[model samples]
Target chain A: MARITREEVERIADLARLTLSAEEAQALTHDLDTMLEYVQALDGLDTQNVEPTAHPLPVATALRPDRARPSLAPEEAVGNAPEREGSAFTVPKVIEGVES
Target chain B: MAQRLGTLSELRAALDDGRTSASDVVAQALGRARELAPAFAATRGLRADRAAEEALQADQRRTARALRSVLDGIPLLLKDNLNHRGEPTTCASRILDGYVSPYDATAVERVKAAGGVVIGRTNMDEFAMGSSTENACDQPTRNPWDPTRVPGGSSGGSAAAVAAGIVPVALGSDTGGSVRQPASFCGVVGIKPTYGRVSRYGLVAFASSLDQVGVFSRTAADAAALLQVISGHDPLDSTSLDEPVPDYAAALDGDVAGLTIGLPREYFVEQGVDPDVLERVRDAVKELERAGAKTCEVSLPHTPYAVATYYLIAMAEASSNLARYDGVRYGHRATGAHDLQSMYSRTRSEGFGAEVKRRILLGTYVLSAGYYDAYYRKAQQARTLLRGDFEAAYRSCDLILTPTAPEVAFALGERSADPLQMYLSDIFTVSANLAGIPGISVPCGFARDLPVGLQLLGPALGESLLLRVADAYQRRTDWHTKTPPEAS
Candidate 1:
């Protein structure tokens, strides 16, 4: 049986950067277990020599001429930013000890 | 007044013959949209002034005898996931609160260039995640046929709007049956072109590989009209195919003679599917047969594993694609965070609903260390076999026919509590997405007073053939003409 423990659920949630309440975590643990069990049906298929198909259609990288083009203005780009200073998007500090 | 506006072609004729003005049609459609938006929660926002301006431009074009295309002055709705410049595109999620798009998606840009006025943006499952529209941060979109039931989602609002007769056509994105299922539920025609047929430049990414922009219309010909306007290669989206787009409407000669359609035996079985839905689909096939199309039985033995494979791939891609919504760039950002980590976690948890969180968690679990081979890799391999099934089946058949969904629209809260049950609702439609083929759902008949959809799938770049068959069937049946009484 494909099973997910509460600890495993919390770990996955952390990796995904999601904050879950204890109740939501427990419920998710059960739901994940149920879904995992369902997807286990893929084990029945004999895909020993089959190649994994990541894209439905074959894709080729499109190339364009290296020419200067007008891009989104700084003001236009940052128009939707919730926290902005001038034309830059403001964010919480990343370094351990950094001055604002 | 709302019900009087016919299909896109009819509207085009009306414009050409000076029987009606673009302003009159757009005004009437927008009026209906405003009147019905509250009851069905079908529209997230309306673009009254922009639509009026566009209509005025179209009228000027008509006066100068310089119409842009058949879609000139035609009013349509866009799913909220598509970015329209200077408009709020929330995708019915709290995360994108107050975020106005700085540019238009390629499809939106094309429609505007063709003089198609945007009446509004429709509601959808946040990030197009669920089978029903109930997963929205805003009010759930209810089925116009029966207000208590759901309009199948995640393009539920687009389907509902078209089915409600507010607009003749709309644009939606289909990843694992979002467009077709809702179109089936709402008794409209929805088309998911080949995976790379339409450019995905400004579409909010849910699952990158599986996502494709689709269209919902009142008829196959109307779908053809809109699909033609928006399809073709775009340099912005590298994944878009560069092949020439055929004349979709012209290909619909209303002739199905000499066509051989394959019916997958696995899908027609009595188990798990509503017997009534199967019957209606069978009857639809019989009608096509009567019109001289040949039928044969084919086996896509891998059909049973499609839903599982679809969810794995879709969620994995969604997890990766949705990582951009961190508190840094744009969208919702939590305040008073001591660290960047807390800001991200708090912003996402506060912004996303329960379903989005669940998918992200499960997606992360599958792609994480020690489990990638067992889950994500295996699903990708399974996807190969699924595609192979279609490739082999197409050898002897021109197209494949199946029921678009397992059942008609169920009550609003019926499957919300159970994610697995909700996933199963996409059984018949996801295979087309997995194989990267084209599929169209047309209204067939009714079960329990709700619309049933008949799905026709074709090989990659086979949109012309699929539309031909769909238009032929629509010509023989009047089901597509029936609108929900709720609109009246």
Candidate 2:
């Protein structure tokens, strides 16, 4: 079985920045164990020499003509914005961070 | 009024024959929508006034070229994550409450140009994450079958709308079974075309590679009617396939005789799959076999890792895609923040729900620098193994079969207590996505009154064959025609 340890759970929580309730966290531990235990089924299969296929269709360098059609007015695009400033939809600033 | 009949093709044929005007159809559809919305929670922000006005012009000489496609005069509910001009595309997330779209998605425009009346936006998961509509930060969309139970999600509203007879067809996005799972749960025909078959231009991305825009309808024929209008190349979405879209409705009755159908032995393993659901799917396969399709017991040995692989990849893409949701350009921002970092932190923290945050965290860790090779890379390799398994299975069979989900709809909060359990709901549906192929869910039967979906998964570019078999199976059974409790 692929053992999912408490440290891994804490690490996943830290990386995801989740403030889990004691109950939710404990519940997640058991569920994750179940998930990993079940997923252990993959480890039994032989994939020794299989070259990974990423893109379904082969990559092509052929390019298409760049075209610009009518654009939705700024007001229309930002109309779904829960918060806005002028033509822009305002959101929290993002940058470098080791968020939990 | 009879001109604007139940099926989309019938409605379009009526328009072609000078029976009723598009305006009349839109008005009637709007009236019905108003009548049904309260009971089913199918739509938000109905655009009857706008749809009726635009549809009136369909008869004018100006829109002649646009009305030539299969969907002329048909109206559809676009799940809210898909942006349409002048429509609120909220994705059922409180973060975008009352938001409006400045532009129409390539898919939306294609349907509209084919003379489909842009009707209204349907409710969905906050960002297309959960299986039940209960995840919507807004209101949960009720199942038409049993209002107390859920219409599967994250496209719950789209399925509910069509299931309740409010609309003949609607668009939904599938990432780990959002479209097909719900179609199965709602007992409707749901088709997730090949991953690149439709453009994702105006769709708010959930999981980039796996997110596919699909259609839901009362029957495979109706779904084909909608697909014929929506599937095409779009310069807007780089990932959209440039190939020609087949006339799905024209090709509806393609021969299924002698086609090989693979029954994946692994999919039947008890991870939580209900026995009744399994039996119904087996019964559906027997029907297909009776119709001349050969059934073979096959194995997708790596099927067990699908859920884990799907979550890691989907969450990784989600974290990256949602990075653009910072306050300045799109989405919501917190009320106050002392500095830039705090502003981003608090806004994101407050904006996303617990599940979404949990996914983002899991995603970030899997893709983290040190752990990349072990978690992310290993999963990608497993994806390769999974695809190889499918390839080997397909060599023996033309199409594969399985139950769309483990069981029918769980009560709203039944699995919400554990996110892993919630994610497990998608186990069966995620494999096709990993391989970038097409899969669809057709109503198998009801277990305790809730519908079970019989999933038909096909090789890449295998939709035409898949639909033909599904249509054939549906023709022999009345399952697809059974309306939910709300409709009755």
Candidate 3:
């Protein structure tokens, strides 16, 4: 069975918030399919009883006392923003007619 | 400087005995960065002003007999992905245009706390993707041994910088053999410590689960000197291990008596690997046996599934991690956006390189609703089995030995066209990351006049033992001391 199609690749690009050119979409369709086929080696493994491992080490939530500490100044936080007005980042209009 | 700067220890000795001043050493390192830029293209930019100021402080502290540590006054390079306060952490990608770090990465902060001088930011594969540095926005870093060949990457610049003698030590992040493969190609020592062994606060997540900051140096001891300063728990990084930091330098007793080094039967097979590279690794094992270490053959049945599993997990994590680069808060923004959604898509599409996009797309596909169970979940279960392989192997041996890469560095653009071929170059090194164990790549010998890396792996928090074995083998052989003729 075909693992993915060019249309699916374009859908994935959309899902990833990336707009791909037609050439890029076609190329990635082939590349992603090849990689998906290669990864089929895992189909032979018996992982039915095996538990999944998201992290290599056991992790516990790290909690500290609630207290305000020194943090990045507002200007510093927005210093690299493409467009900022008074320590706030300006983005494209989010709502239907409201300015953002 | 009166004496030639070779290793961190040698430079420290020179500084202690008044052979060279800290300012002069920093000047020499900065000068080398500029002189070698055209040939290697290793660093993004040199921090000449900051280095001079830090060197002066180090000298004043030395005069007061308040020398901080082994890293004090030592000039070193940081991979461009890592934040260095005021410096731009580009990750060698155009997506991060006009962005500068507001705070220091935990590793960088620790190094600065010890008075270590930051010399420059080294180039790397964009977002620590790709086995070769060719995926970067900047010119690829070439191997110092043969300028026409590639320095294996995404940490290729750090490896090349150390190999070419631009600096004694450099920092790089290893998600899937980024540091070690490049180190092997460049004939330097690269070490990826156990997961959570080093803090990842400002390292810029490539794969949050597998990413760990690593070191590249000419010798294990020099790596140890820098690793010591950078390792330890940081409250900033929740995943950072809270365990006590070991005395890495003191562990280098050059003694490997009674240590059992396991050689994975799968990795030593006749096919896939270059014959000469295998021979060098076998000879390296024999040298270790001569120095009082025992060898055994072990099986990691899940070895064949590592590459697939590694990519699945890495890409899934990368997709999520890279979603932050959508141009709203920082980094490159599209010029003309009619709406918010197009702005994000256009910014990312324009900013990311080919490889980065390919990975993001694959990652998105794997994690999508329909394919999640078949791909991502299955790969995770296989990851558990893979870790079990290491756990079982470690019961019989204290350390595992293998070739770092199947072959030496290939010519530039040789494997760039084939992503699978380039991904396979990391075959021998990625397993350690998947298992979240410590592994080191040390120069064993040469093949076709190119460096071959002999890898040594240990279980979780086994850095001390791994370093001991590597330090012992390096002591017995001159491979670690051999410098590129062009570099010398």
Candidate 4:
């Protein structure tokens, strides 16, 4: 029964690391409100004791024995990197945009 | 015309007979693509040199007594998301702009092994996150049927390319109706193979478990050929099936005498499905009845919650899968790095589009502390009921029938303004992904001159049976071969 507020939407965007323009935040607030309203239809279903299913297939708890598997060379793994520096995968830093 | 009147069958025949060259076919397709490019804007990546190499090899095979398979020397298009070796696989995202894959997807490898030439990669909704092509980061692919209207997405380009006669067949992926929706709008045959029937290795993971490789073609037979070539086990993808590939093309001949087709009661009424599209679907069902198949009105009791549950699960997977795109260890990196947060924030905020950002935000929140049990876990429970609805329907029928998309293609800006309206475009499609079943969309009829598709959804690994039913319908109807009006 709780409505998605503008602040909640803005905060969620912040956590998502997205800088939302006011229009976007306002639009998402309205959209998320409608979405939650529609999603709430499932709340009325009688699933009190029923267990939730994660995957549809019958996957058992099994793994190949812990034998040494052939490993891709570091170069092989780094070969596909869009940014590589001396055999190590290099990446752009993102966290510093927010002030400490 | 895109090419001469030969169907995919005839096209492949000429290739095998050495009467046509693969390079020639690619050249012809590329020429048509250039001519019709204004109509649908159907392409994203055009691999001219690689296609030339493939055509040369195919030419050698034609000269010798070598035949690879039914797909030999056939030029095909791939949606932008599927990884291709030596070509950029951008998935229509700025972050991945200029990013290239070093290996081919298992499905791509299999298609090439069958002697099919990958001529180009088509456009799509950025990260396959939207129902209309308007969400594409670059240009929106137009519907060949109506130049001003959209080709449905996120597989719009694949559909338009095939519909415009640019390629007899193309590869597409369906997470939540990506292939089938556009297949309908473009009036082509689109088949989303049963989950794991085709390996997803190197597909760039948009909601991993829900994503399955599918195909788009002008006919059911073309789709069958593509599916057979790509269906098999790969040691690389654990989910790939080891089951023997069935004779899908051969299975097309089986009579539909004893088949029970389910007409879901909810899929027809007040669910916002357009009446004209529903009417065409009903006519297709009537045609099936005339083919000696019986029809039953069935119920998928939990049909209403399908979209919500689909979004929850897909977003959860997407948030996890997209986590790998962090600006480290590969992909686009912002040059100015004051700190780690700045790096991630600038990279992601700049890298992703609005829809992708929106979904990621929603997904992250649902999986965040305090809300996981309520939203994410509850949606998982609803998913079980949604799957059960399909299972119950199947108990009374061999396959269930419905309209592929709610309506035919809308104008470019019609649904672009409202994301929710676009989400509703997938109401009839999301359930199949929820259940991980094989679903196909066949050209049934037109609504207001644009194409409408009749969807046939079948059980897991039921590709053979599904194709037979579709083939029967296709044989009885010429709608599948009916090209869009504007393309003509």
Candidate 1, lDDT over the whole model: 0.93
Give the residue spans of candidate 1 off by over 4 A. B1-4
| Candidate 2 chain B: 10-residue stretch with minimal lDDT | B1-10
Model 3 residue pairs with clashes: none
What is candidate 4's local distance difference test score? Answer: 0.84
Candidate 1, residue A19: CA error in Å?
0.7
Q: Tell me the deviation in Å of residue A63 in model 3.
A: 1.3
How many residue-pair clashes does candidate 2 contain?
14
For model 3 the local lDDT of residue B222 reads: 90
Compared with the true structure, what per-residue lDDT tens digits does model 3 show for residues B145-211?
Answer: 9999989999999999999888899999999999999999999999999999999999999999999
Q: Give lDDT tens digits, candidate 2, residues A42-92.
A: 556455666655555554554767787776677755655656777775544
For residues B71-149, what per-residue lDDT tens digits would candidate 1 score against the true structure?
9999999999999999999989999998899999999999999999998899999999998999999799999999999
Candidate 4 vs. true structure, TM-score: 0.95
Worst 10 residues of 4 chain B by lDDT: B1-10
Model 3 chain B: weakest 10-residue lDDT segment is: B1-10
Across B191-255, the per-residue lDDT of candidate 2 in tens digits comes to 99888899889899988878989999878888887887778777777778889887676666846
Q: For model 4, what is the error of residue B30's alpha carbon versus the real structure, in angstroms, after optimal superposition?
A: 1.7
Cα error, candidate 1, residue A38 (Å): 0.4
Clash number for each model: 0, 14, 0, 14
| Candidate with better TM-score, 2 vs 4 | 4
What's the residue-level lDDT of B487 in candidate 2? 67
DockQ for model 3? 0.91
